[model samples]
Target: MTTPPHHPARRNLLRVAAAGAVSAAGLAAATPAWGRTTAAPASPPPGLSDPVQRGDLVVDVRDHGAVGDGVADDTAAIQAALDEGRGRTVYIPPGTYPVSTMLTVFGGTTVLATATTVIRRTDGPSIVGNGVLGDMTATGFDGESDIVIQGGVWDVNASNVALNGNGFSFSHGRNIRVYDVRVRDVQGWHAMELNAVETVRVVNCRFEGFSDPQGNRQYSEAVHMDYAGGPGHFTLFGAPDFYGCKDVEVSGCYAGPSADFPSYPRLVGSHGGPDGHQHTGLRVVSNYADQCTEWAVRLYDWLDGVVQGNQIVGGGGGIQIGPAGVQTGGNVVVSGNTLRGLAGVQEAAGRPPDAAICVGRLNNARTHRLTVADNVVEGVAMEGISVYRTDGCVVSGNVVEDCEGAGIRLHDAPRAVVTSNAVARTGGESIVVADASNAALVAQNRADDATAAGVRVTGTVAEVVVRGNVVRGDAAYGIAIGAGATGTWHTGNDLRGGYTTGPVDDQGSGSLTDPAGVA
Candidate 1:
């Protein structure tokens, strides 16, 4: 692939323009010539700022006996600046610094570079030059404790470049930021991996060229978080392992082209192991995931996190909440997002179809309190939302269109509240409640142009409250309550399509009072 050119002079001019803006009073008082704002002095080139104007201890990586041009090993020269300790800035001049090994940043070190400064690697093992990877497995030194690596291009030739590898790796240090950078071409795992680190923020970054054709190994994820991978025959780490890494925020980033199939990307998650206590208090917001072969965002296990305001398109599933055999629960909310063109029918083309949002088992045999609400789903081949083996969850206020299976599905869950959703043009039932016992509520939703019933409740559903809903243009019955269902109260609902059991009495012992004469 052809690389983009880096212009230092243009960057310098932009920086001057940014710093040149002044208050109206100051501009008028200082300079009135030519109607321009303020008179500013000419600034030096980006990396060539005077020592007095530069940050503390500016050690140029190229001047410290390092070489660029996609060759020559500059690991030692770069490591020297990291060894200088806190409150120092390492300046990388405008050139491509090829790395064959990982480079670790120590506490109080700031790596500030121009856009022309590129840290890259050649094709080799997953481990390659200068950027942080498996070779440097130390803690509290890779962008931790007020360390910042900003304003540069980081091109990864290999995959799995991690700042801290696993749970054994811990950085108590805080306030780390990797901002305004570009990371490209990671072959395995994540482009940027942070394990058990505190207060880490990645903003305004781009990760590209992460693909695996053979599918032998997992391909690329832009940003990854988890507890350290644990030991023994079982490879994955448990949920408690990542509890140390809290308050992690990843915003305004992009990751794509993860696997051979354009629809699936590698899984992104905080929980890695069977223990089901890994990640907690995390936020993955305002990001974009395109051409992913798998899930766009996967939350394995945790509590109190928001996956909001994201654009996820062309993935196997937009979001997979809790995988089977994991207990991820408590105050988790997935809201206000746009997920389109999810490929769910390909997995079940011959068998029964599935849903778009697949909520798997609760963690450690425990129920969770989940809220999946206020999202727009379009062009999904399966159900719009699917719940499996979860309890005390609310799936409400979502709009789904052009789905092949049920719009909202409840399977083997108890006490779930499905309300205020609008589903249209579905090939199957608009809402299906299956095997849910102990009182579930399906209320105030609209199902239109469904081939089957608007609501189908089956398999031991008890004490269900189907109230204040509208069903129209269904080919079959408007509502079908199965034989085993008990104590169901169908109250004040509009059923435009005829019912199979004739006009059953409202379970609340109330009469239909609407002017249309049906409820």
Candidate 2:
């Protein structure tokens, strides 16, 4: 499946087009395999009247001495039904089935449900799909393929302990697909837990109402994917610990904690990627995340991912890249998202006022070649978008407005581009490049009604270019090149009738060639 170097963009376009189809055929076709094959159901299974008879396999939980009454424990009968459903389709009729224990889906089986179907987790962990094969003596790599879990409403009654319960847990598998499922009231760690998996496609799912009964929101997550051992290792957990997964996609889903409670819901996160085995090739698109106390989307030590076309609201931060001692892998793209009102969301302990979109390093770790474009970040408490200690990044075509602090700030970022952005009514500087930033381009941006300077270059910056920008209604200097800054070039800006401290104040030894036209 190798295409030409010029063909990647075209291929991505086709894949995105194919991913939006509502049919299983379209999903199977659009999805690319990391290490295994995926064969979608060619046609919908026969009606839900009789036992599902596919070839020699037949599974009817009712025929296995099971009752779907909401009182009885049907775990043994349903487990027997699943055992009979190996290599076939296991069908559950539309009723309230009380499962007292975990039900495992063997390899090559499908669970299809009707509109009124419900699986209630009464005890033990919810559901486990073990895709690992063999003794697993080595460091990485395991088994199982083509495991599909789709179309059911799995519910846990907000039980308040983190023992082993997860709505669905799948690990050590390739080409695993979960489609059109809804999970609610999960009382454990996460709604869905995926670890050490490759080529996972979770589409059109709804996960809601994650809670901690002990009043500790730190452990609750909607979808957790971590605990990757080595490449292809078959590891699993109920909470996310992204260690070594690759080629993962979580698309077209609605995920949140409680709609009523202001709590910390780790919407999605990846923790430790050990031994330099970075979790890579992730795609998170077209999802809705709401009321998160932590970030709606976050990554640590991750590389080569795309977070696009999402509607994220009321989170600690809308999307957070590497933070504090985590060195991120390169070429991450964040675009086409609508993120609003993160400053008023519930904050976790030791967390500061959050940004709508941010890429930074708190310790010695660094981020490179990141792209933040075409996003709308408004009504935030701090900077709308901040790039700190990152190199070779691009901040373009974004609308950042009505923030309590600077609209866009670049600190210690070298060789970066900040272009074609709109910043308005910020409490601090609209755009700032400071702390030894060099060789940066600040071009074609517009700033208005800023409480501080429109564009401020300070802290010993060098070789910076400020060109073709428009600044109006700023409270302080329109373009301020502070003292001790050198090698600055200010040219062709439009700054008239708005600055209280006057325009184009050059305190440095750089050239300002457009004094009359700009100031």
Cα shift from native, residue 305, model 2 (Å): 0.3
Among these predictions, the greatest TM-score belongs to 2
lDDT score, candidate 1: 0.62
Q: In angstroms, give how far residue 151 of model 2 lies from its true place.
A: 0.8
Q: How does candidate 2 fare on TM-score?
A: 0.82
Report the C-alpha lDDT of model 1 over 182-274, residue by residue, as the tens digit: 766665455666555667777777766664545644423566665544442112212223233567777777766523223226435654545
Model 2 regions lying over 4 Å from their true place? 1-58, 131-141, 159-164, 229-243, 257-264, 323-327, 344-351, 511-519
Instruction: Report how far off residue 514 is in candidate 2 (Å).
Output: 6.4
Models 1 onward score TM values of 0.77, 0.82
lDDT of 2 by residue, 289-314 (tens): 87776678877666898989888887
